[model samples]
Target: MDKALPRTIACVTAVLGLALALAGPAAATPGVPAPEASADGTLVSRTGTAVTVTAAVGLSNTISVWQAGDTIRVRDTGDTVTALGGCRPVSANEAVCPGAGSLTELVVHAGDQADDVTSFLESLGVTLVGGAGDDSLYGGGANDTLEGDEGADFLSGGGGNDTLTGSSGRDRLFGGPGNDSIEGRGGGDLINAGAGNDVVSGGNGNDQVIAGTGNDFVDGGPGQDTLDAVDEVGGNDYVRGGDESDTCRADLGDSVTECP
Candidate 1:
């Protein structure tokens, strides 16, 4: 990454006297590939955030705990991982981790357990990949991207306009208070575009879409999907059930077509 990460992380170590001792990029694994591109930001954390920060993708069934300066690889057995980025534990799910690299976007692999991975409030355009267990992935107050890879997952975008994608398992994609875009890539999914205008797509399964109170667009791609905007206080939403046997319901200010 040519861009230098934000300098905030250096401040944390200088203030706390923590043993950051940042490491160079770990040698790449045999078959796994490095990330295609990297975004720039410091990696901070909040409490109750599952899945430790990572430098590598495609990890499985393990929490990759790296140090302040360590490359984002899974912590080897002999590698010493400190206390929540060397700050003392605040709670059971300790966070407030302070670290950063050249890239800010993330492609997580949180393994087979349920996880709640939330980006820092200062982050933007982060991309996370959840695991096979029910997970909740949240984008912060800026434009971000998240992918629910498997299991019954929940992807929510915060105040900034964001993008949410789902996978083969049932999912809930919520575009929070910003004008956002979301797609249920697979499975029987629930797409809720919560406040602000949005674009929603049910990729390839029986889906239920809730376009909440915004001038929005909904597309049920290829299954018996339910496009619902029946609330009285809803906005003018355009609903479409693609070339499939689907159900499209809406209010007066909305327009629906192509259900047949």
Candidate 2:
């Protein structure tokens, strides 16, 4: 951690607020105030220094923390963050942090984790994605999407437009932001929506999904699945698919999708 950077990490509680505060680093161009992070969200800073982040518990996924000057990508293992770009040797094990190009496109991709990576982000007040050993994901205040390739993963879209995919795992997903999308490709999965128009899909397994508080779309691709709209307002929802024995419940002004 650098001594000049602020000690307090801002944890953003809302995606829209984060977007309004800093309109993506991509637009900032060169020679501007880099995106400064706080426990509440991103801030404006013109300093170059390193900050040590203490990891939080019960939060899975890898976080890519960015600054205008430079970055130090710390991996749980040497191969934890695959495809590392612009990382130079800093010490025997640590390397110089890589720049995230632009703020609009802050890319921090996590490959696999033996534990929950969310705690690290929460402690540091950042948002990120990657593999989890538990396969269960809890979303935060940033617009994030996650995928679990194995095990039964549970995911929540805390805020912002999010996309979640549980590939090859029985998963649970929740959409809690801007029009969100979810896909569960294996095992039985569950999905829920909150405060935004959403699209959810289940594949090759028995699944349960609900569209709550927004005009939403639910797609139960295969196997015995359940779709319900007990907690939703105007926007209209679509429920599609029927494999083996599937059930669907809806209200008026909602679209029911049953495509064979």
Q: Best by lDDT, which number?
A: 1
Per-residue lDDT tens digits for candidate 2, residues 82-110, read 22234444433233444433223332323
Deviation from native of the Cα of residue 109 in model 1, angstroms: 3.9
| C-alpha lDDT values of all predictions | 0.58, 0.50
lDDT by residue (138-159, candidate 1, tens digit) is 7778787676776889888877
Alpha-carbon RMSD, candidate 2 = 15.4
Off by over 4 Å in 1: 1-52, 55-108, 231-235
Alpha carbon lDDT at 110, candidate 1: 43
Candidate 2 lands at a TM-score of: 0.57
The CA lDDT at 7 in model 1 is 34
> Ten residues in a row with the worst lDDT in model 1?
21-30
Tell me how many residue pairs clash in candidate 1: 6
TM-score of predicted structure 1: 0.61
Residue 107's lDDT within candidate 2 is 27
